[model samples]
Every structure is written in structure tokens, then in C-alpha cells.
Target chain A: MAKIKNLAELRKMREEQQKQLNLREKSNDPEKYVQIKVGMATSGIASGAKRIMDFLIVELDKRGIEAVVTQTGDMGYCYAEPTIEVTRPGEEPIVFGYVDTQRADEIIEKYIKNGELVEGIIPVNYESID
Target chain B: MAQQLKMQLLVCGGTGCRASESESIEAALARELKAHGLENEAKVITTGCFGFCEKGPIVKVHPDNTFYTQVTPADAREIVEEHVLKGRKVERLLYTDPENKEHVPDSRHMGFYRKQIRIALRNCGFINPENIDEYLARDGYEALGKCLAEMTPDAVIDIMKKSGLRGRGGGGFPTGLKWEITRKSVADQKYVVCNADEGDPGAFMDRSILEGDPHAILEAMAICGYAIGATKGLIYIRAEYPLAIKRLKIAIDQAMEYGLLGKNIFETGFDFDVELRYGAGAFVCGEETALIHSMEGSRGEPTFKPPFPSVEGYMGKPTNVNNVETFANVPIIINKGADWFASIGTERSKGTKVFALAGKINNVGLIEVPMGTTLREVIFEIGGGIKDGKEFKAVQTGGPSGGCLTQKHLDIPIEYETLVEAGSMMGSGGMIVMDEDDCMVSMAKFYLEFTVEESCGKCSPCRIGNKRLHEMLETVTEGKATMETLEKLKNLSNVIKDTSLCGLGQTAPNPVLSTLNNFWDEYLEHVEDHKCRAGACKSLMRYVIIPDNCVGCTACARNCPVNCISGERKQVHEIDQSTCIKCGTCMEKCKFNAIEIV
Candidate 1:
């Protein structure tokens, strides 16, 4: 690892580093890029959230899609262990459930790239606090 | 550059999960991946504590985001074969709702994570703690960078003030005010100290933050140093937290190597370095003044304020002391504007608080929620209600210095002021839920005993007054106390609270006062009726036989360990009140369920 010369160098390194990680931070500018959050709590990990997150990252990057996928702690949807919340440009975040590789592929290809909804959509049940 | 991998599996490497053999799970997953010749396609990463430690050894699969819980090393083979090879989620490892038989596949729908906001613990469970790049990728040091580059020390303090961030070290002091006081104090050499002693018995959110995201503390400390015009920082942590210590050392070394710390930071001529100091973990030493005294090689006992740590701290120089969780929130407050934080929590306490939810909780773990969130939301909604479907009795927060809150206070929003009004304080965010089985009087005694042990003895009111209070509660539990002793208990506890030297002694009687106020009827039952309705105080309960239910069962007579049951065979069993012990073995032995406690 090289010593970062300044904040710019550090920021540059972080931008590159973030690509390897599925960084799913919610951004104020929703139209910038697609953001995906995979539930990676204990249940998520035991059910194989790491694999799904990695697959989404690698496959999305491979497919030349602009997206940020990251690991989020339990979103309280433990019933949907392999769950991912996908938000495309200027759209609401939609949570999907029990996403096996087949579902992950369809989610990325249809929902992400072509802007179409697919199966395994886990409805958001919680009401936001004022 | 190489393309992204096809799949990834993340195993929880938290202390709880590691104790449950998550390491073996990680190794087994890697081996399985290698055996399948998919090592290049799939990756296995071990992250930090997921905060859901109740069901540990958690494994998460990426690409599809499958969450599996309570996974042992033995299940790794099937996880790899079925889940990894064929992309089928291993159904057995999934968390099945205890109430409902439905298997929960994602953590998002779980009751534990729904109401939680996770501000202080934002980066905790998600990333690998050891990797500096991972920390940086999450906009980690951007706060410090922004502080040094754009904002002046006063400007940074202004942002903190506007954010309304209070000290999460149980003090509830305004963080910005503490910084401003230290900044105004005249000193040549100043220091910024992070109090990570976290001596609360069941509290570990501080420990988790250190282990999960050590860089967060380091980054926040640097920002603090920058904000307070100090170049040296110290972390006063407990020796018991070896993992947190090791991770902090790694983060410091990495930051130093990356030019994030130690001289000419960001090429802005700003220099800051962080060092670690281990404490014996005296609960009283959590007080900032005492903590500073301990750091300075003086007596660990707390001294009077006005000369508070901000004015006279760390070798008698101006200093700033903040809790680990307090500092953990700094970087985020800087990165995102103060208003972003101020918008989340209540008007007074403008951010989320990380609570170590333990004791009689269905989902016992760390949860960070917005400050305005209610106790009902925490205990029932996020904690999955009381354990075993028992009725909730009370919750003890703020460690020994805090008081117990009853069911009537459940709906009240959990702000610092709100908790204080309810005869409880949110001390370091330790929420220990107690069920109906727990006795309020004994619960007060339990906290009093802890206070008696941890008292610095710097003052006599706490030393003598707390002892007397305990003796009264002790006598009450033994069913030997009169109503006069109960009055003495309340009076003595008030004296202790009023005259104690430090926060330790000042708030020592909170448990006794709070319990007596909340459960006065229970206390009356113990003193007047000589009965413990909860059956928690064993000496107050007696073992007897209901004559109607006793159908000449000799089993009670034979099983009585002390031969206290003297009735002959084919006759109603009678437990001799004088000689009988309250062991309840006769109750267990009686096939007719004749024996009962009267």
C-alpha cells in the first residue's frame, strides 16, 4: 500500500476501494446510480448473504452496469434471509426475498438493467417514524 | 483490473460468533469453495459483529443476500454443496420465528432490526474491521479531512453544537459545549481522551464498536483533536477488551502508515497521534475526572469539578474526554452536516443511541435507535418482546448509577430528559429488561450491592448510607423488616443521593428510590404480609401441602430431603412448619401436585 499524499489521493483510493465492496449507502441524489443493499446480519450471513452480495457486485460490474451494492445489517425481514433492496435511478427502493442465484440474475438483468420488476419482492411493512 | 466475483459468502467473526465456531464455519466454507473449483468465482469474507449475537455463527451469502443463523461448522458442507454449488438457500440454517413456524430468510423482516436506526453502529457489522481500505471506502476519514480542510476549529464546534450531540458515556453533556470549553481553556499541550472503560456489567456496545470498526474511533479521535486544537490523543480502554485493544492498535498503525495520523496530515500541516492506556476497569473510574486521574498515574478516585476534565485534565493540561460511542458518532456528524443528525433524534438529544439490550430479552443484542424511540418500541418491537412470553416488569438502564423504569413508563420516548423524569437515566445505553419473575425490591438490592462494591469511598454518605440502605432491603427480603425499616431505607437512600461525592455516589441510590416508588405495594407485602409474590426472595416463601389436593401421597414424605414431611403413608402429607426447608423437593416428588408454596 502506498502512503496517500493528500486528501485527494486518499479520496481517489477510497473510490477505487469502494468498487470491490458492495457499498450500499443511501444517497441524496437517487438518480446518480442504482444502489443495492443486501441483508448481512447473522441470519443473512448464515443463509449466504456474502455470496449474493459478491455475485451482484461482480456480475453487475461485468455487465457494465453502474451500481453500488453493499452489505446492510438485519433490515428486520428475517423471514427473507437472502433479501436485497434494489433502487434504480429516480425510483423507490424495492426489497426482494429468498434471492437464490436465479433470482439474483433476474434482479440484475431485468430490474436493474432494463427497469422491470421480477419475483421475490418483499413488501416494506414498517412505517417510518416522524 | 479484475471484474467482480460471481458470489461471496460473509461469516460473522464477532466474539460471540467466534465462540460459536464461526471461524470453523469460515474455514469450512473456503475449503468447500476450493473443492468445488469455484474459489476464483466465489469469495469468503469474515466481517464484524452483526449486532444480532443471540443467534450467532451467522453466515450470509452475497449476490442473492441469503441470511442463515445458528450455523455450526458441521453445516458448512451442506451450505457449500446445496447453497454454494446449486445456489439453493440451506433451509435448515434459516431463522424460524419461535412464535410462528415460518422460516425467516432475510434479517430485514425480523423484529430486532426494524426499529433500529444504527447510527453509532452504522459500519459495525457490515465491513471487515482490519482493512483500512474498507473503512475509507465507507467515507470514514472524510469527516476528519473535511474538518481540517474546510472548517475551522470553531466552525467544527459550531457544527457539533448545532447537531445537539450529547455525550453517550451516560453523562448526557453536550459534546459541543465540552469541546468549546476545552478549546477556550489556555494550555500549551492539550489532549483528547476517549473513555472506553465501559465497566457496565452487561454493556458491550463500546467493545463491539472497537472490534467492529476500530477506524471509526481513530478517525473520530483525530477529528476531535483537530477540533479542540490538540495534536495528541489517548484512548482509556479496559484491559479486559483485548480484541478491541488489538483492533485499535491495528487501526492506529494503519492510519499512521496511511498518513491519516502522526504529522502533516492531509499535507495541511496538521499533526495528531493516538495512544492506548489500559485501566483496571473500576466502574467509578468511568467518571471523566477519575478517568483522567487514572490516566495521569494519580489515584483513580474522582475529584471535584469547576476544574472539570475540560479545564484540568491529563497531567493538568486542558483536555477533552468523550465516550467511545460519543466519539464514534463524531465522524458521521462531520461528514453529514449537523442538521442531518439533528433531524433524526429528539430536539435535545439529536442522534441515535447504541444500547446493549440484555437480560430477559428475547433478542438480546446491541441496537442503535433514534433517541426519541420509546421503551415499548425497544423492548417489544425491536427486542421481540420479553423472553418466554413473560409479562414485562421493569427495565434497568444506566448501569448502577441509573434507576429502574416500570411498565407505566414504557410508552415514554427515550430522551435523556425523559428518562431522568421517569426516575431512570440512559446511562451508557444499557437496557436490561426484567420480567414479572424479577422482584423489584431484590432488583434494587442487586444494584445497591454493585454500588457498594464500586464506591471510591471518597465520601462517607455513599459509603455508610448505601450500606444502611442495602441492609434495610436485605432485611426486607428476609421477611424480618418492619415498616419503620422501610422508612429508614427511603431516608438513607435520599441522603446518599444528596451527599455523595461523585456521579458514582450521587446516583447510587437511584435503584432503591426508583424501585420503592414503582413497587411500594410489593415492599409492603414483604414487610407487613411477610410474603414475596414473585417468589424471588426464597426466605419469605414457605413449602406446604393443600389438604384437599394431598391424597395420602407418601412421595412427598419420602422425597423431603430433611425428613420434614412426617405424615404416614395413605394419609394427607403434612410438612412440619418448624423443621421444613423451602427446598420444594416435595412439590417435585408429589405425583398428585399436592405440595404448594403457602
Candidate 2:
């Protein structure tokens, strides 16, 4: 580690560390960041949902996007194995079906980064009450 | 690929939780995470006190915010497997509300944390105190860097003055004014002192802050050093706080290596450094004058105030002394502007006050609540009410120097002036709640006994007056004092308060005076009827056997250590009143619920 020489140096170090050290901070207010939930039930896992979840987790950070990627039970879209729901800040959650690494990257680039929609959109048919 | 933390397991490393083996719990968590190959995915960080000490060791899972209480080392495996792996909360370990008996998974829903506003304790239970990087990540030394690079000495002092922060060490003096006074004093060698000598009984607020976030103190002291035009800073911490001392040393070394502490910090041509001065844990040394004296290798006794510490402190050089909690709040006030802090608390007392809540309370822990939070809210809402479904008798604030506040004073907002007006000073924020079972007369005697023991015998008023005060309390509790004795007790307490030289001697008689003012009826009963309603005064209590209820099993007679109970087997017993020792051992031995204290 280098010694902080000036205000600019300290600020630079803080800004760099803040990004890497923001997991706990992001968790505090998930709504402020991009929240992604992957289906991880038995049926979903049999269809390589684990690989897709890992791909999303690694790819999102590599792209310098702040996000909380958590796993949930089957979103009742067993027909579309490896389903994922993406909720951007102040936006409604959108479910994308048959999400592989390719589609996950497209979702990150088109949907998450630019707020543009891509194909394989699964419209909500049920109201999930909290 | 950079290691992305999906989850963080925050195990409480505060002194209270550590006593319950939180360190082993942290290791067990790390081990379980390693066994499952989820070590990098989920990080287990040993943070400072979570403040919910009643149910510890506490393991809080971040992102999901699942709060697990009373966790043992053995439960770590299940937490890593179930909570970490499967994203399932451990049902049994959740904090069950004392009112509804419903398990609350998150801390946000619990009554203990709902009303608290953590400012002084902002980084306490969050970051690893040993790592300066984590502290930096949370804008740790930004205040010092900002102060050195941008603001002038007077400019920084103006911010402190506008923030309305008082000295959290029970004196309620304006912190900025103290700094200004020291800055005005013409001394080539002025000093900034952080008073970490927290000697209040049952108070660990300062100790927790030091152990949890030592850098906060270091940074604040440097900021004070800059504001007061002082190059040297000393932390007068008690030697008993080994963990705090260790952490402070680590923080100091780390800050120096980072070029944040020693000389020419931030290349701003400002040099400020801090070192620790250990107190022998004398309660009187908590006072600034006594603390300065003790640091100077002299007697730990306070001197008269016209030449205050800010004027002629620490080798006759102007020295500024502030409490640990007061220093802890400085960085936050500087980071978030004065108005932001000034908006949280009451008019006179700004920012939050950290209190070590103990005694007969459901949640006995360290809590920081904003000023003007009522006693009812702290005792009932945040404290989870009295323990064992008992009625609250009185709440004692400010340690031995503070006074007891009864039920009538519950609704008053807890500002410094309000507490003092209600016959109690906020002396280091030790709030001990007393339940119905605690006797008021005996409670006053208990505090008097502590004062008698801790009173630095520098003045005759404190040395002799407090000793005589304790004797009068003894006489009252023993049921031998008349009404004339009570009058003398009140008169002597006032004399001690008026004639004493220092704050310790001045406030030593508060408990006696306050209890006498609040529970005069209880005192009358002890003196006139020769009976203690609470049964706390043993001498005033008599053990009598209920004739009808006695089974005559000879248990009481056989177990009586002094042979006070005499009866043959299969016959009712009779207690010899003259020979009874009031030990109440026979009461425990009775099987038929025969013996009762009258």
C-alpha cells in the first residue's frame, strides 16, 4: 500500500476502495443498486442455473456495475429453466427466461447499463405479495 | 477476477460478546465457510460490539440482514451451511420480542434497535477496527485530511461550535469553546487530550468505541490538534482497557505508516501526533484536572477550576480534554455538516449520547440514542422494558455521581440539562434500571458505598462527609435511625455538595439526596415501622413460620445454620426471633412454603 500524500491521493484511494468495499454498503440499500435474483431450486439447478448465476455474479463486477446478485427458489418458470429477475433502481423488476451467459451479458449491457430491453422477456402472470 | 463478496458474516467482537466466546464463534464460522468452499464467496468479519449484549454472541448476516442472537461456537456450522449456502435463516436463534414472543429475523424489526440512532457508534459494529483500510473505506480520516488541506484552525472550530456538540464526559461543556480557549492561550506547547478514562460503574461506552474504532479517536484528536493549534495529542485511557489500548496502538502505527498522523500530514505543513497515557483506573481521574495530574505523574485528584485544563493543564501548558465519545462524534460532524448533526438531537444537547444500559433491563447493552429521547422510550421501547416481567422502580443515571429518577420523571426528554434538573447529571451515560424488587433506601446506600470507596481523599468534605453520609445510610437501612438522623443526612449531603473542591466531591452526595427526595416514604417506613417493604434491608426483616402451612418435615430446623428454628418432626415449627440471624437459609430449606420474611 502507498502512503496517502495529499487530499487528491486520499480521495483517489477512498474512491477506489469504496467500489471494492461496497458489498456491505450495497447490501444496506439494495434498492439503490441493481438487484438480480437467480432461480436456484432443484429443477432450475438441473438445467445449469448454478453456472448462469456464477456467470452473472462475475460478469456484473467485471463490467464495473454495482449490483447485489442473490439466489431465490424457482420463480415458477420451470419451463424456462435458468430464469433470472433484474430490478434496476426505481424500476419494476423484469424476468428474463432461458438466461445463459450470452443473454446475461446482453441484459447487463442493454438492459442494466442503458435501460434498454432485450428479447426473452417473461411477463409477470402472478402478483408476489410481501 | 477480483474477489466479489456476496455476503459478509459480522460476528460481534465487543467486550460483552467476547466474554461469551465470540472469538471462537468467528473462527468456527471461518472454518465452516472453508469446509463448504464458500470462504471467498462469503466473508466472516469480526466487527465491534453489536450492542445487543443480552443475547450474544450475535452473528448478523449482511445483505439479508438476518440477526442471530445468543449464538454459540457450535452453531456456526449451521449458519454457514443454512444461511450462507441455502439462504435460509436459523429460526431458533432469532431475537424473539419480549412482548409478543415472535421471532424477529432482522434487527430493524426488533424493539432493542428501532429507536436508536448510531452516530458516535457509527463504525462500531460495522468495520474491523484492526484494519485501517476498512476505516478509510468508511471516510475515516477524511475529516483530518479535509481540515488540514482546506479549512483554517478557526474555520474548523467554528464548525464544531455550530454543531452544538457538548463534552460527552458528563460535564456538558461546549467542545468548540474549550478548543477556542486553548487556542487563545499563549503557549508554545499546547496539547489535545482524549479522556478515555471511563471509570463509571457498568459503563463501557468509551471502551467499546476505543476497541471498535480507535482511528476515530485518533482522527478526531488530530482534528482537535489542528483546531486548537496543538501539535501533540495524548489519550488518557485507563490501563484496564487492554483491548482498547491494543487497538489504539495499532491504529496509531497504521496512521503513521499511512502518513496521516505524524508530521506534515497531507503535505499541508501541519504536524500532529497522538500517544496513549494510561490511568490506574481511578474514578476521580475521569475529571480533567485529576486526569492531567495523573498523566503528569502526580496525585489523581482534581484542583479548583479558575485555571481550568484549557488554561493551565498538563505541565502548565494549555490542554484541551474531551471524552472518547465526544471525539468519536467529531469526524461524523465534520463529514456530514454541522446542520446534519444539529438536526438529530435536542436544542441544548446536540448529536447522540452513547449509554451503557445495565441493571434489571431486558436488553442490557451499549446503546446510542439521540438527545431528547425520553426515558420511557429508552427503558421500555429500546431497552425491551424491565426484566422478568417486573415493574420498574427507578432508573439510576450517571453512576455514583448521578441520582435516581422515579416513574414520574419517565416522560421527560433526556437532555443534559433535563437530567440535571431532575436531580441527575448525565455522568458518562451509565443508565442502570431498578425494578420493583430493589429497595430505594438500600439503593442509595449502595451508591453511597461506591462513592465512599472511590472518593479521592483530597478534601475533608469529600473524605469525611461522604464517609459520614455512608454511615447515615447504613443507620437508615439497619432501622436504627430516627427522623432527626434523616434531617442530618439531608443537611450533610448539601454541605458536601456545596463545600467540595472538585466535581467528584460535589456530586458524591447526589444519590443520597435524590433517593431521599424521591422515596421519603420508604425511609419513613424503615425508621418508624421498623420494616422494609422490599425486604432488601435484612436487619429490618424478620423470618416467621406460617403455622398452618408448616409440614413439620424438620427441613427448616435441620437446615437453619444458627438453630433459630426449633420443632420436633411432624410438628409445626417456631422461629426464635431473638436468635434469628436473618440469613433466610431456612426459607430455602422449607418445602411447605412455611417461612416468610415479615
Candidate 3:
């Protein structure tokens, strides 16, 4: 809780923090987790994709959904931005598009929670080198 | 069980595409779908910029990925009827390769995108940046979590140092060195600042990223804080970027609620958070020192830097500042290891640089290419050559601060060192391609005018020097400047560049000097003959009608504002050279193949 007064103390603190960071990385299960991918290509952002991605995270947490979230460079379907791909343990990834905060919330409740496909489910329009 | 059916139309909504009225096309598509009773089956969704901006207003039909280009509002009904209802691809709207005239089915087949390796621009058009979980799913903060748990603050800094990532924010400062300096400097508080003040003309790379992938910046800054032992970050974005700022605010709020930003991020006890500070549209604030001063509620002016921001910045504390593009690259470098990044770019410039490829080029949008990519490839191959088949005169990299490079420098690799060697600096990646139609003298004058307006006036050299330089350019354009005036202009430019307090003032003369060196003949013609070679200087140009080609319907006379043309209806119009104001309205209005600029 004290302020670091010198370089030596700061160096010591940094080392101690690194040890803690190492432990966290070691414990993460990369394969067992569900992944959500958001498209962030230039076209995607212009279409308000950032807002949709933010909404999904907050709504998912409120509903106690356990998933790993991340952003990918343009998925080439810039036209279908604010695009989201939801992947569960045994299910094929379901990609949705043109998602807003409201649609994102509905997706969490109907599709993510109750296993129902709601509106705005954008089928992968184009084949990319996934 | 009822079969669930749904269709989505994703439209290219980037600025380049929008300029061609992509929004109108989107609206039309939605309206047609509804009219056809397929509104329930189809939903029109707007998304971020797909990088292939040349063939834009791009429409992709979902589930099948039928890529359509140049879709106007008129074609929206057919798209809804044929593509949505009949399930047939719209063959005419497909992008045909210029060389082979082959209809490219998908983005993968396009030559423009085949060579690109997107990192910083990774998430731009892909996901909703507002959604925190979507960002989480893409392994966004896994690097942050990984850094918090496994890596020491020193280790994180070490990895960044080894990554060979230089600042994309024009200065090319080593990212690792900056962090080390800030981390070493002892202060009651340290800060991480993301300079989103992208003021370079024709540059929108940072704006697109902030709009599409706000979280990437957030995640990168958090990682930066954890590495440098800083707990607070500030994003100094321009107020002009309304959409980018809105998304950034949303991303920040979402990160905080999900425990990604505030104390104990991923339970690591690293209390770091970010806040946004809007810049008042000052170009100087793009500089780190000026940016820090602006954040501290002071005038956005550059100061002498012996104690760099790394030693004492914003509110006089140790601070690390990186631009939007710089921070966008961090998460990848940390996640993929330093060697992976170092291997991608040239030996010295080790990463992809994003450019707002504008002016004369066919593809006027954001493009990210490797450091060693040639100017020729970017201008001709990727940009689809010059617009209207105009001859490539020169390409101006680094905005007003950078020099104009001609065809001789076309094949030179676009690295920072090579650009500098070519008499230009690889500034914040604004590559404005100029064609033969562009008057170099006038171009220089245009840029000088902009610099004159933007100078903060704190320093004498920039304020006074730029005003005088602008006046000289105006004189040259008006055919009133003498050879003596030209010499004075050159001398003043050198003094301003050498003595100016900040980057804004220092580089104000780049446009003038570069044009003078490359297009000295044009200037000579202007002074000696009082003629604008490109016919761009209105005062030096006159509109004349050729007798043979003119079947005069009085079109020119009717359109002339100053009554410069004295001719009856159905007679060849005679333009009175003495009375002519040289507005060129007569030339544009004349339907006959008669009007010529002399």
C-alpha cells in the first residue's frame, strides 16, 4: 500500500507482480473455454460493432455466462458488422450480425440462455480463410 | 419441429463507402425487403470497413457470402427480389478485376487483400466494439490476464522491448524504451496516455480503430499500465471524432462493469483504469508534450523537451504516451511473442503501418501493409492505379510535414528510413497520391495555407514564417512573385524548420521545399511566362473557345458570371480575356468540345 520511493523498490515490486502474473497464465484452460469473436475491421467499426460487443459482455456477465471474449481484425464481411460468433463446447459456432445493444441482450436471454435462435442471426455470408 | 430461417445483409459502412451513399443503399435494401414480404426472412445490418474499399458500397448476402459491389439504391429492389427471394447471385454487381476482368467471388480472390496481414486493424470490421464479451471471446484480454498472472512488470516490458515495435505515431520511438523510462522514473503517480488526436489530413486509421475496436486500445493500455506499474490511463482523442469517442466511452464503461479496467483486473491486484479527454482540434496536440499539456488543462502548445514526457508529463509525473495505432499493436505483440512481430516488418521498421490512402488513388480508405512494401505497389497495385487514368506525378507521405516524392522514389521501400532518405518522413501514415493534373506549386500553396491556419502562434518561426511563406505562395500562384521572392521563401522555410519549437512549426515548410525541388520548372514557367502549367492557378489561366469545335448554343455566354463572353445565341462564343475573372464556370458549362484552358 506504500508508494515506491526508488528504482530498486520499483524493480522489486515489478518482479513480485510478474510472479503472480505467471501463476494466472499457467492456470488458464485455453481449450475448455467458450469463445466469442467480434469483427473489428474498418467497415465493422463504422457500423457500430464496438457497441454491440460491449453490450454482449455486460449482459453475459449479468446472466452468469462464462465465456472468453476477443476481437479479430476485419472478417472481410465489413457490411455485416457488429458481427458476433458464439461458440459453445459441442455446438458449431453461430455467427450473428448487425447486432445492437438491444439485440445483443435478447441474444443472451433467448439464444445464449434458453437455446433459442432469435432475429438478426446472420449466417456466414461469405467464406473466409477461417 | 418448425425449421428456423433467417437471413442478414451486411453492408460496408466505412467512410469511403459512405461517401458513395452506401447508407442510402442500406435503407433501400431494407425498404425493398419489407415491401417484398421478406422482411422477416431478411435483416439489413450495417458493419465496419472491409479493407477492400476500392470496390465499395459493398453488400454481402448472408449464409452464401455473395459479395456485391457498387450497389446503388436503385438496385436494392432487384437485390431483395433476386438474391433474397430467388436465391440467385447478382452477377453484375460482383467486382471484376481490372487486369483480367474476372468477377472475383469473395474477398480472398481480390489481389488487394491477399498480401495484407492485419493486426492492429484485426477487430475493426469484425465485431461490435461496444460488447465486452465479444471482445473477451476473441482472446482480447487474455494477454492482460496472462501478463497479470504469469509475467512480471519487468518481463512484460522486456517482451515489448524485444518485440521491435516502434511508435506508429510518427516519431518512431521504441515502445519498450519509453515504457522503461516511465517505469524507472520515480513519481507519486505515473500515467499511460493514448493519443487518439489523429489530425493529419486524409488520415482515418486511428478513427476507424477507435470506432470498431475500442477495446483493443483499452486492453493494450491496461497491459501497458500493468507493465509500467501505472494505475491510470488517459485517452486524448480529438473532439471531431464523435463516433470514435462515443464507442470509446462505451468500451470503457463496459470494461469497468466487467472488472476488466478497475482494481484487481482478473484478480491480479493491478488497479488500473482509463478516462477520455477530448482535444480541441489542435494539430500540435498530436505531439506527446503538447498532448500532455492539453490533458493537464493547459494550452495545447509544444515545450522544450530535455525532460521528456517519460520523465515528467501530464501534471508533472512520469508518463508513457503512444498513439492509437501504437497501442492497437501491443496486445498482439504480447500475445504472439516479440519474435513473431519482429519477423513481419523490415529490419529497422518492424511492423505493419496503417495508411489513410487518399488523393488521386482509386482506393481511398484505410490500408495496412508491411514496412518494406514499395510505394509503387501501394499506389498502382493495391490502390488500383490513379483515378480517371491520370498520370502519377508524386505521392506525399506524412501529410503537410512530409515532402513530395516523385516517380523516382516509387520503387523505394516505404520504411521510415527510406522515406527520410527520399526527402520525406514516414509521418502518421497519410499517403496522398498526386496525379499529373495536380499542380505542385498550387499543392504546396494549399498545404502552406493549412499550416498557416493551424499554427498555435506560441513560437515566432512557425507563426511568422508560415504567414510569410503562405503570402509568397499566393504571389507565385497569382503570377506576381519575382525570383527574389522565391529565394526569400526558401530561406524563410529553412529557418522555420530549423528553429521552430514543435513538430507543427518545424515541418510546415515540407510541402514548399519538396515542391520547389521537384517542380522547379513549373515555378519558373509561372514566373517567366505568367502561365500555370497545370492550369490550376486561376489568375494565370484563361478560357478560350476553339472556332472549329464550337457549335455555340450560347451555353458558355449564359453560364459566364462576369459577362466575359460576348456572343449571340447559336454563334461561336468569344471570351473577352481582359474582362474574364477566370472562374472557369463557362468551361464546365459548355457542352461543345470547344473550351480550352490557356
- Measured over all alpha carbons after superposition, the RMSD of each candidate to the real structure, in angstroms, is 6.8, 2.1, 11.5
TM-score of 2: 0.95
Q: Candidates' TM-scores?
A: 0.87, 0.95, 0.77
Among these predicted structures, which one has the highest DockQ? 2
Docking class of 1: incorrect
Q: Chain A TM-score for each candidate, in the given order?
A: 0.75, 0.85, 0.69
Best by lDDT: 2
* Interface RMS deviation of candidate 3: 16.1
DockQ, all models: 0.21, 0.52, 0.03
Residue pairs with colliding backbones in model 2 are: none
Count of backbone collisions in candidate 2: 0
Candidate 2 TM-score restricted to chain A: 0.85
Write one digit per residue (lDDT tens) for candidate 1, span B418-535: 9999998989988899998998889889988998898888889988888888888999998999999988888888888788889999999999889889999999999999998898
Rank order by TM-score, top first? 2, 1, 3
Please, what are the lDDT tens digits per residue for candidate 3 over residues A28-97?
A: 3323445577776567767876566556655564576765554555655556677888776577788887
Docking class of 3: incorrect
The candidate with the higher DockQ, 2 or 3, is: 2
Model 3's alpha-carbon lDDT is 0.80
